[model samples]
Target: MRRTSARSRISRALAVATAVAAVAGLTAYQGVAAEPAARTLAAGSPEGYGAGTTGGAGGPTVTVTSADAFIDAAASDGPLQIQVNGTIQLDDMEKVTSNKTIVGTGTRGRITGGGLNVSKASNVIIQNLTFSGSDDDAINVQYSTRVWIDHNDISDAYDGACDVKRASDGVTVSWNHFHDQDKNALLGHSDDNGSEDRGKLHVSYHHNWFDATTQRNPRVRFGNPVHVYNNYYYNNSGYGVASTEEAGVLVEGNYFENVKDPYHLGEADSGPGSLVARNNQLVNSGSGQTGGSVSTPSYSYRLDPAANVKSIVTSGSGVGHV
Candidate 1:
């Protein structure tokens, strides 16, 4: 039993009507700081840092200055804290696998003319960096799992900014800034080829800010079952979030300052099935929608009542449990 928002409201009504329960908790999505985890992949490599074994147990606190040497010498174990005193070129293809952490030197330091391509990797973390004048995706994830991308600024990507593809699962993107891209700042794919079908795929986006000055393209492509939360989108020349086909989706707790919606649901297909939306603050945005599906928000808590709810639920509520 999946309970829709209507059922949740009805349950509240019934409880009020019969006085069976008092004050059903307001169903709201909280923000997960994901900040500490944002710093490094983990603490120490209790298991030792290597490419095969889950990379490092945590992130290494190592610091580097050059992008050329950092990519060549970086290991999957621990955080690779590199400071870019000057501009670095990323023309060489780099492979990040297992749980590796890559943090840029200064936010002002820029990575130009290279692609941070993720291929067949898992548990990868990249943040606090900037990419400009990249011919391809500044960041790309393929056949990966458990990826966390936050707090980076990307722009002027001739192709796209970020792309998630090839049956990737358990991805969380938050607190990033985007500008001047040809496609979504965040994109997902259930299957890269037509042969593979969607069996299990889950992704989440939170607390991102987007500003598009040109009419290049939109900000998000929702290709899989995704959860979009608490983001601030503005000056988008295109859609905020859209889907190529039907997907299980949830859009909630977002603050849209100025946007244009080609579809009310931000999708080309009728829309995704089992879609849930609530508490989304939209201002000066279009309300065009498409598709057919059941979408609502804040109903999971109402369907099954539980005690000590905090343990079972974790979000951006000043706590970090991912």
Candidate 2:
């Protein structure tokens, strides 16, 4: 979020001055202070930070109001944190570069009528933002790795709200709210693009609130083992999670209320995949099919109870309050 106004700048300056003065006083009195604690990703979240991800670590924040500037800030060399204050409308696709953390300031921060392209980027984290009316995908990631998308509200996109494809690996999508959308999310691009997609696209999708989304609460493709867990689904018109085109998915501990299709192994014409469904709660909904089993993920995550998913997700999912 940008401090563009004079009042905002003055307020920030005064706040910084007060903080510096207080810190100096405390240091002088105590003679020394404790070392800062090391930062970690949110607990039980399995986003890879082993060798390829450091999203905006120890970098200055660059606040902007336009989509072009946001992309420019992300495209810079070093890790950077980019904040968008108000809604930014775009006429073209904005490409987010590598090693960036893009966060919205508050409830009013949003991206409208545009799309974010996270192609070939690594260590990117996008959170606390609202995306709507996008001419294309609200957020598209291809050939990327170690990305985390959390606490966002995405709706009414022209294409899929969030699509990850082209061998993207080690990603986590958590605590997002999806409503009034169609083709919500997609894992792989196509069935024919199998070679590039093989043995890639490992992701964790958890704690999301999907309300009335039409379909593709992530339709998956080949060589992807997506873990879908502890999500809340309300009155969904289409399927909840589809594991198609040889894709493997583990659907577990989800709450489905009045949804038509809670989970399925494959699409209408797509090749059959594998899914393991367990501990799901269904109320006035269909418990979808399970064909085979998928291999377990290489990471660990704590799963919330399916019976309490509605309460847990409703109280914490989406932007502005994170």
User: For residues 119-168, could you state the per-residue lDDT of candidate 1 as single tens digits?
Assistant: 77775666667778887778777777767666677788777777766666
Model 2 lDDT at residue 276: 89
Q: Which stretches of candidate 1 lie over 4 Å from their true place?
A: 1-60, 74-86, 106-109, 189-197, 213-224, 262-275, 290-322
What is the Cα-based TM-score of model 2?
0.84
lDDT of 1 at 292: 51
Per-model TM against the reference: 0.65, 0.84
Candidate 2 lDDT by residue in tens digits, 1-322:
4313422432343334334532432111111111111222222233422224557654445456655455455555655666677888776567877877777877766899888889888888888899999999999999998888889999999999999999888888888999989899899988788899989988888889998898888799985468888999998887898999889898989999998888887787788899988999999999688988798877666788899999999999998657
Q: How far out, in Å, is residue 149 in model 2?
A: 0.4
Q: Could you report the Cα RMSD, in angstroms, for every candidate shown?
A: 18.2, 7.0
